[model samples]
Target: MELKIDESIIKAYGFTHQNINIQQIGSGHINGTYLLTKLPSNEKFVLQYINTNVFTNPKAIANNIQAVASFLNQQFPTYLFPAPLLTVNGENMATYNGSYWRLSPFVDDTVALDTLSSPKQAYEAAKQFGKLSRLLNGFDSNKLQATIIGFHDLVLRFEQFENALANANTAFKTKAAEEIEAAINYQYILNNYLEIKDVLPDRVMHHDTKISNVLLDQNSYEGVCVIDLDTLMPGKFISDLGDMMRTYLCEFSENETDFSKINIREDYFAAMIEGYLYEMGSILTKKEKEAILFSGKYIIYMQALRFLSDYLNGSVYYPIHYPTQNLDRAKNQLKLLQELVDNEEKLQDIINQSLLKVI
Candidate 1:
């Protein structure tokens, strides 16, 4: 597919490369991403068009990245973060044709895997994410802007699900009766968030902690950097850990039709716990440590609710491939949630054992 590139937007970045080529890359759901390569120099960069509809303030997104990058550079100079390139006018982002755009130097010799191919990969990814949280622990999270307000608020998500169910069309209501009941059966999960909100420390969270967001070294298979900084904001530690569990532990993607393929991998779960706790265990309080295992259940149930809500509301939020895609995704998540619930004791054991090793 040919992506339309605004040459003026590229020139605004004031690149000295004479020959440039641009092509769309990645399967990102939120923003439009492209690879811009300079021919003679062979230099490459990633240019992204921010999804303004989801993020009302594009400049705020840039500001958050800039702040986080600066902090990481100063504190953990060895860590690699894709710092946003400044435009000719010294702006981190530019508005062209009513769209927001930003650029960053591409890290070569690395790949972003969509799934965990090995337990080592899982450990590396988790360690990198946990390291990011630990490194930024001292940074004031209030300085960052909430790109999407109420993004990880489970209470708000539950309310939206209830509202969608009440007003759903008859066909949807009839077809999704089982899923709706399953969602409501897990209302206690949202209740847990409300009960613990007071104690859960609000830290700088990488709200989107999917495996794909962590770039892995092509040769060593170690995690190099955590990409996709658009969702960086102040949030509960569970939000980051839960998101990792949601995406990393599952053997199948959220949209899988085969229920049998949706089981959580215990080995991967152990790796995640061991790796995350290795970096973050020292900083986490006793309460936070106790709550770590439950983060998976919290995020999975919330995601199921979000998917079912979108399905009931005529699939407005997430893009759907088929008419029943959202419904299938909801079912997949619910199945994963059930697995987590069944293995809750085992997961807690892993967490406990992992923490003990760190001690």
Candidate 2:
């Protein structure tokens, strides 16, 4: 696809290379991303147009990235983080043609997979995310801005779901009645966040922990960096780990239509726990450790609620390919949630065993 980005925008970043080549890369659902390669040196960088529709305040997002990157640079210089590239004006982000843009030097010799190709990949991704949390344990979370207001506020999500269900058209409500009832029955799972928020210490969380967000070494498959810092903000550590569970442990993507293919992979779950607790085990309090397994249930059900809410409300929030795509996604997540519930004991056992190993 041809993008209409201006050459001046590229030049503003001040690349010293003589010739540059830019091409779109990745399967990102949000925001447009391109890989910029400098000739001769073959050094590459990532330039992205911030999706303003999803993020209303580009400056706030830039500020969050800068803060997190600055802290990480000082505390863990060896860690690979995609720090934002500054423009000639000395700004992390620039406004051009009424759109926001940012740049970051690409991590060399690393690959980001759209899905987990192996249990090792799952473990590596989990370890990197967990290590990131551990590194930021001392950083002040309140100083970070909420790039997306109420991004992970479960109480607000429930309220929005309730409003959407109440205001839903009769035909729409009737069609999604079964899913709505399933969501209502599982309100307790979503409420887990409220119960644990007071006990668990709030820290910097990478709210989006999908496998694609992690970059792995091309040869060794070792996870090198945790990219996609748009959703970096103050939140529960479980939410971040839960996202790892929701995305990595699953046998299929959330959009898969075949419900039978959506079972939680027990091996992947075990690997994730082993990798996560390797970094987080000692730091997590008794209460936090106890709540570890349920984190998966919480995030999975919360996602289902969000999908169902959007479907009932005429799919305003998420882009839908078909009329009932959101409904299908809702059912997919609910099915995954049910599988996670069925295997809750087994998952808890894995967590306990992994914790034992670390201890």
Candidate 3:
């Protein structure tokens, strides 16, 4: 965690660390994040050096944030956007020591959770992400760069799985036989996506909707605003909501090995669907609404494919603790996908009821 933050970098922004106390914050793996506080004035700003390896074009990120912040300010003046503070040279990002850096004022009295404790937290997070897309409904998605290309495209993933299955070693493939069958059987999910993708409108999406990505009021637990804008890009609406469904509906994560503990929480699903549709229902067309209910399946199946494919490729993409850990994770996501499928009728009923009130 040792960061040699040059004194000149702080001074370039017309601030001095001598008057400010710096402390490391956030558990993000991609960037080096810190909170800089001026004690006497009681002002706090979040500072970070962009991880150039993962995000090759740092200025594209800066430009996208600036554009989104400008839109939020002009359209929804009250919304909180953690827009990057411009350098003295009027640039959104500053290059120093061969890395890009930016600063933004910290929103006081807000906290982010790495896990969900209640269904209400699920609702609040989903609502905030949905509201952001609703607000940016008019923004041109083509203007934003794809930070990671085909990050959520099931078509590419399906091919990746097929290639891995075809070329996988015989013994490892046999070891993962059950999970491999499940992956092949789940090809229908990819077909379902292909059928609906053309009609599902691409929007200005969060691209990553983990609960940790939203800052909530510390006391009320209501959402304050969304954070972690590195993944902001042009993507289908399902990428965000489906990600929420994948991560929030189940109590345990994909790492859990106990299959019995992987059941979907109906109440959490209801809250998330209600919250997201409450904001996005009117904006979505009939085809999109009919198609979006299976978002959980879409995400879970794709993730299972990724894990299974990685396992077939000798455990390359994801680090494996034991030999079959990736296979176990694939099984975990598949079991959860089955739970969603089994309760599909009930969940569809919930979606129908939510649409009645929101649309």
How high is each candidate's TM-score? 0.97, 0.96, 0.94
Model 1: per-residue Cα lDDT over 1-359, one tens digit each: 23466777878887533578787898787789889898777789999888888889988888898999999889889888888899999989877789888998899999988778898999999998998999999999999999999898888999999999989999999999999999988888878878887798889999999888999999999889899999899998999899989998887899889999988888999998888988999999888888997798889998999999999999998989899999999999999999999988888888889999877
Where in model 2 is the C-alpha error above 4 Å? 15-18
Query: In candidate 1, how many Å is residue 121 off?
Result: 0.9
Tens-place lDDT digits, model 3, residues 223-267: 899998988988888889889988998899889999999998999
Provide the lDDT at 17 for model 3: 70
- Model 1: how far is 190 from its true place, Å? 1.2
* Lowest summed lDDT window (length 10), candidate 2: 1-10
**lDDT scores in order:** 0.89, 0.87, 0.88
Candidate 2 clashing pairs, residues 3+ apart or interchain: none
Error of 1 at 85 (Å): 1.2
RMSD of each: 1.4, 1.6, 1.8
Local accuracy of candidate 2 as per-residue lDDT tens digits, 1-359: 34667877787887632588888997987889999998867888898988888889888889988998899899999877787889999989867888888999899889999888789999999999999999999899999888899887788889999999889999999999899999999988766677778888888999999989999999999989899899988988878888888898877887899988988889998888888888888888899899998888888888998999999899998888899999999999999999988988888888889989877
